[model samples]
Target: MKFLPIFLDSKAGPILLIGAGDPVRARLRLLLAAGARVRWHATDGDFAVAGLDAVAASRIERLETNPGAADLGAIVAVFCAGAGEIGVTVAARARASGLPVNVMDDPAHSSFIVPAIVDRGDVVVAVGTGGASPVVARRVRERIEALLPARIGDLAALIGRWRKAVHARIPDMPLRRRFWERVVDGPIGASVLAGRSDEAEDSLQAIADPSAYAGASAPGTVEGRVTLVGAGPGDPDLLTIKALRALQDADIVFYDELVSPEILDRARRDAVRIPVGRRVGKPGIGQDAINRLLIDAAKSGQRAVRLKGGDPFIFGRGGEEIEALREAGVACSVIPGITAGLGAAAESELPLTFRHEALRVTFLTAHKARDASSVDWSALTDRKMTVVVYMGTTAANAIRDGLLAAGRSPETPVGVFARATRPDAKSVVGTLDHLPALVREIDGGPAILVIGDVVSHSAPWRNASPTPLFHTFQMAAE
Candidate 1:
């Protein structure tokens, strides 16, 4: 490192400002704020002691003529703000006397340079290019000021107050770090950032005792279990706190085919991730084999988490897995996440139920609902009934024929939501007569097709900035 940067504890000794100039006044004020006893030895009266009368302790005259052997004991730092001969003389004597000294506008002569400091009450950020460029340093400080809120210092102060108590209670390293990370970066952090001191204290006290927060969330016994958690749609912002906590505590994660990488990034760092994926028209691991894997992992006492995309309960076959775990006498639980149909509907601004137009909503899986007894086709065929189908893309023709044969109108408006809730979520809209072809045209993954007269009530995006909500068509969804 070319520049030796250190924060002087100004409270330790006196700050000696040797010249009266613009630089001298600024440095003097900073030292005063830092609780330093400042004294000036300048002969000039232009930049006088008008403002420093009360703040500065003394402004005495130095009687020692030759500074090469001057008594310079009992000093923290010295600043020479003069331009030519005096600046060089003061810096030389101070450096020779083993004192940290700075000469203004001359890097070669100085042992220390004053820095651009951002003081946030408890938090201080010092920016120094070591006299390379002060203008650039100030500009960088202004940008940092914009990104940081005023309450961050208050938050830091609160942590300082509670650190002793927290340290006394938490002796384990990993658990303490996890607790602090949640308190400082999770909802509690947001509460403190909004400047509610009472709320901050309440949250801090709640998590200070590890057992108080870890009972329900943390693993109690060495006997391992798997939690099947849904990662929600593409947006990480949409993930529930339960899902996030599960990811935090996971030892190993076995993820699904369709789960987004953004969601997986939230998992614990030490946790190993294995892709137990299934792709379209591909031979993947069978359900029985996956169940055996989970059972085997649990039998060996490993915390295995089976993570899936969207609501695991919806079309994820999570029930069958749970049943299989029960049969094998293994412990397991499920946390439902935001389903794709609901996420897409909300983003697309489509009302699943309207006043007498579409009074009932049905969510049916095309692949699963097609087995044994078919879906309540008669009820689904009602004009007032809205139907959301998953895994319906490949069986679009079969589904269209079934709905029409069950007495649905050919003119019933329908929409197919492709890759719902993602950045590039696409939708195909047309009457029921034209839906199969419309579904075929769009080849995106995991499409949710909505059927009923209510589909005409669904909003359309104009592919513009800040897409308007719930518009029929530019001509009609106005």
Candidate 2:
């Protein structure tokens, strides 16, 4: 590293500066503004800069230090404030004498490089790349400084004024964290970011109790449904617009298993995150607890979002939760996400329905068939029908055997997708006759079982180069 960084004691008297260039003047201005006396040094034995400030210039003498004559007296730091070889030579001398020094435009001889600093009243932001690239650092600083709202300083100052009151009102760390989450997510942060400190202050003050405002005043609350969104199989870029809006506006989030942690991270950092996650076939968060939590949050007047994986309404137990919300008189809605079937189809380049290949489609659950003994064999054996079985990976053999025994084609193409749509998604293509055994061989994920002739037309696995798919479901008209 050519340059080092150090903090200077601005209280040190009379900063000794050698050379009289623009760099020298700029450094002097900073010192003067910070209330420091400065003494300038020049090699010509005369003051060279014109119209300089009224600093005692008689002491600004020649820089011909004859080695032994070099004084280690009262100077705290040195600045070689001129250009070319002279500044370089002087910097070498200062370094040898163990004095902290800055050489103009020369990182090689400098002990420290100055950072680009932004000062907005009491708000200061400093940017530095440690002199690796000053121009790049400056440009980055400009971009960041531009993004800061002019009124942010006002908002910050306002918040600072009330810090004592807030601390007294909510001293517990958990409670304070929860309170701040709502204030930042609901309206205060937005208002401040938009340059409306008054509005931000009002919103922040309203958090005397966040749950008390969980009505329309709360985002994602009230007339707004607490739509448990299925972020769809996995790829974050595939989120539906409705889901995205819900995530962006959510005041609190309760996410679950199979849902991407990366997707949950998309929510506002200040939003209260609750993990009510569950795993398939393992005892999970009780349904009653989840239902009560959702209702309690809604009644408290907060935008409560329950984020899930795949289609919330598709084997995600979204139906039971919606029923619970409805019974509690909470307005509820659902945003369908890409089910495993569709995700696999898209990633594997297989259309669930092709031209004239699949005239009918059916989504079924093999886990709890209502009529295992009463299934219409003829109806299922129809050549034009495509069946998508949810959560059937474990019972794949029974499903495949039933289809074959029902006079269906033995070679009917079957596609099994594991972790569909995610970056690590994979698909297996084979016939229904061998699908049961194949399911066990593959590393299990959120599996989708597609049995249909349409699978024949799909090409081998392909990449899911992102698109909008989460909100693909038709919204029910109010």
Candidate 3:
């Protein structure tokens, strides 16, 4: 961040405003609305207040003296808009005095830049682009303004009123924080936001114990739990809303290696992150150890999140994690995500099941040659069944042999989609006999192999030249 975002106390002291014209007038309105007394030095001598109310206009003290030569002792900050050379001169003086100053549209001379703001009484959201693009900032501010509840400021004010009592009641810092979380995320806050502040006040006052209200079993101990969240096939946007919430609420996150850094970036900034996934060849903290970590985190009254790539239930060992949490008496919940196979199919425009040509779809894992050999390939030999093989890159040759020996046609179309839904995603398409070769054409693994005639209907296949054996398509970065 080029400039640290902070809300300066508008009531600190009178702001020195030296400028003229409509831009200066706009800045004047913003300063007055923020409740700051202004010491105005209108360079053009046009001290007009045409639209401002009497009370606000009365606070402005217009001066004829040049601001550069005036006393700087009482000024808290400085703002210069449409002031030309005089603005730059005043900016240098303010900087020398160690005061914050903003020269409109001039970041080089300004100590701070104003941001596009969304105001809702006590609640305010500021959007900035470090003086790069005001339009972009305004656009973001619009989105935030729409998402925020109209009375969210009322809810904040309500909390402010009750904060002292709650803080005294729940002296433990963590428990006190959780108590506020319960209030803001629960019915009391909802009531306030719904314009029922009186009812919300009564509800808050009726609570006998703030600690108990915060979900603590005792006065000082908070109740912690685990949430299994799906990271969703490499793309951060594919994450479900609930999954996003869990990440934000997590006190600590135990994430898989497959979870993208962009996805992890969405978690609470202060939350502790620990990687616990096993890579293809490299060892990881074992599953038993991972389960113990989750149990321990909850036992210590920390909200923990086990972040897995793709839907937790679909070959993600989510069921196993749930069992472990249950056995350890840890409360848990699950949020599903888009699995890799489905993500790959959508990204490549490949249908897992097509009309008539493919009536059934099967998803299985083949991490090793022995694993592929043990599969009941005969059942998968049906011409109408589409087969999706996970972790099949290394065992591609074995997969090809097993299906061919099981009476599956060697000419069946197949696709290898790698890094599905990511910027560097790639795909290779060919017949079943060349499935291993097709896999070899891809740059890397963490890929899935799709087999059956349905692969011929994919975008990659359609876009490819009419090659008899194979076609490769490296997807351009989005």
Candidate 4:
């Protein structure tokens, strides 16, 4: 990020404002509303607080001295608008003093850029595009303004007032946080937001044991649990709302190697991230060890998230993890994601099921040749069944041999889609007879193989020219 978003304490000290015109006026009002004392040097010498309140106008100290020589000792920040060359000079001076400065519409001369603000009393949202696009920032601010509750700030103020009491009642840090979470998510916070602060206060005061209200087993102990989140097909946007919330709430995350960095970034900033899943050819912390980690994390009162790529239930070993967590008496829940097969199909426009041509869709894995050989290929030989093979890159030949040997036609269309919904995703399409060759054309694994007549209807299949292998296979069949 070009600029870090921060809420500067406006009451810390006076802000030196140097400028004129509407932009300066707008910034002046913003600073005043934020309760900042302003030392104004209106370059045009019109220091009129025409529309401002008497209280706010009284806070502004109009400076007759040249702003370039003005003492910046007690100033916390500097803002320049319509000051032109003088703004640039003052910006350089502020930077030398190690103070944050902003030259309106000029990021090159500024240490900080003002963001579009969504003000909800105590709850303020700042939307910034790093000075690249103010319009975009404003647009984002509008969306945030719409989503935030009108009285959400009132809820924050209530929490602030009761924070010390809650802390005193629940000394354990985790347990105390839980207490506030319960208040904010439960009826007490709702009452405050619904314009019944008195009722909310009474309800809160009536809670005999805040620890009990916060779901603490003992006076100081907090309950911890595991949330198995499905990170969908390398796309952060594809994550389920619940999955995103789980990530945001997690104290620690044990993520698969296939989970994209973008998806990992969704987790809470302070969350402890550990890679536990196996990579392409490298072994990982074994599943048993991973389970132990999860159990231990929860037993220690930390919210743990097992972030797996794609849908947890779809060949993701989610069932095994669930069983392990259950046996360990750890509370756990799952949030499903868009699996790689479905992601690949959607991206490539490869219909897994088509009316009479492809009726059934079977998802299987062939991580190695032995795995492919052991598969019940006979059952998958039906012309109308679409077979999606996961982790089949290494066992491509084995898959072709097994399917062809089981009377699945070599003429069956197939598409090898790699990286699924990721930006670098690639697809190769041809007859099943050239399945191994098709797999070879892809850049890497974490790819899926779609086998069925319906593959011929995919975008890649239609767009691709017939390869020599496809031509050769067709000739042999002819």
How well is each residue in 349-438 modelled by candidate 4, as lDDT tens digits? 788899989889999999999999999999999999999999999999999999999999988888888888877777888889999888
For model 1, how big is the CA root-mean-square deviation?
10.9
**Best model number under lDDT:** 3
Candidate 1: lDDT of 49? 43
Which pairs of residues have clashing backbones in candidate 3?
A: none
Q: In candidate 1, which residue pairs get closer than 3 Å at backbone N, Cα or C atoms, i.e. clash? A: 472-477, 473-477
Off by over 4 Å in 3: 1-3, 67-74, 92-98
Instruction: Rate residue 477 of model 4 by lDDT.
Output: 11
Evaluate all candidate structures by whole-model CA lDDT and list the values in order: 0.74, 0.68, 0.92, 0.88
Per-residue CA lDDT of model 1 for 1-478, tens digit only, reads: 4577788898787667666567666666677778777656553644454455554535333333443333577877887776357768878888888889888879899997777788887788888887999898899899888878888888788878977777667665444555566677777778888978789888777664463353224433245688999887677888899989989888789888888887889999888898887987788798888888888877665667899888879888888889998998889999888998888788778888999788899998875335313765777887888999887887777777788888898777777887777766777677787776777755656788888777666665333223222222221121
Between candidates 2 and 4, which one is better according to lDDT? 4
lDDT of the structure predicted as candidate 2? 0.68
Better of 3 and 4 by TM-score: 4
The residue-level lDDT of candidate 1 at 311 comes to 82
- Which consecutive 10 residues in model 4 have the weakest lDDT in total? 469-478
Per-residue accuracy of model 3 over 1-478 as CA lDDT, tens digit each: 7889999898999999999999899999999999999999999999987889998998899999976775677899999999999999989999999999999999999999999999998998889999999999999999998899999999999989988988888888778878888899999989998899999999998999888988889778988899999898899999999999999988999999999999999999999999999789888889899999999999999999999998899889999999999999999999999999999999999989888889999999999999999999999999899999989999999999999999999999999999999998999998999988899899897898999999889999998877548898887777
Among these predicted structures, which one has the highest TM-score?
4
Residue 39's lDDT in candidate 4: 94
The sequence of per-residue lDDT tens digits that candidate 2 reaches over residues 297-339 is: 8776567899988889887789999999999998878888877
RMSD of 3: 2.4
